[model samples]
Target: MESGPAIFAGTTFALFGAGLLLWTGARVLHREPVALGVRPSVSLISATLSGVVFLALGVWCFGRM
Candidate 1:
């Protein structure tokens, strides 16, 4: 049988990644720093890089399915 749960998880991850990228871009335009809640120190570069990583992970999941 086809894996329904995997498809849902993949879609959720992909959407989260896309939203993170958009949020990071907005912060960049407004000259604000971003944080992932793991540390007190926020940086624009880290936020942008994280967005890319999440996006790549989502794409990879989709490819696996």
Candidate 2:
């Protein structure tokens, strides 16, 4: 399998995760009310986990490359 796709995928995932983290952090810090019945803690935790997963994937992809 070509490594190019892996690298791209990893980078994309990382970027998406980072964006989520930032958005969530902002919402929490701003004390924004929850939308769609979602809890603040849930959003924050999800964002953090997503960021971690993406970071791990990016690292793995970089190693493969």
Candidate 3:
């Protein structure tokens, strides 16, 4: 079903996003530089955005089915 795909995609996105958030948080806590050329603040913002997006995706997926 279409809902199956949506749930799978949502779960994948959410897991990846959570992982990124945890990694970024560790980097920030350790005062380490990011792999990308982006600044710390930018990276943090990006991570936060990604986490929010994934969380929203999960909510939407569950809500739909």
Number of the top candidate by TM-score?
A: 3
After superposing all C-alphas onto the true structure, candidate 1 shows an RMSD in angstroms of: 3.3
Over 12-44, each residue of candidate 2 has an lDDT whose tens digit, in order, gives: 877877777777677778888434477767766
lDDT per residue for candidate 1 within 1-65, as digits (tens), equals 36566677778778888898899788767866566454424566676778788778778777877
Better of 1 and 2 by TM-score: 2
Question: Highest lDDT among the candidates is held by which one?
Answer: 3
Model 2: what TM-score? Answer: 0.75
lDDT of 2 at 8: 91
Report the Cα lDDT for residue 41, model 2: 75
Better of 2 and 3 by TM-score: 3
* lDDT: the better of candidates 1 and 2: 2
| Candidate 3 structure quality by residue, lDDT tens digits, 1-65 | 77898888778877877777788778878989755798778877877788778877877776776
User: Tell me, what's the RMSD of every candidate?
Assistant: 3.3, 2.1, 1.7
Count of steric clashes across candidates, in order = 0, 0, 0
Cα deviation of 36, candidate 2, in Å: 2.8
State the TM-score for model 1: 0.72
lDDT of candidate 3 at residue 55, scale 0 to 100: 73
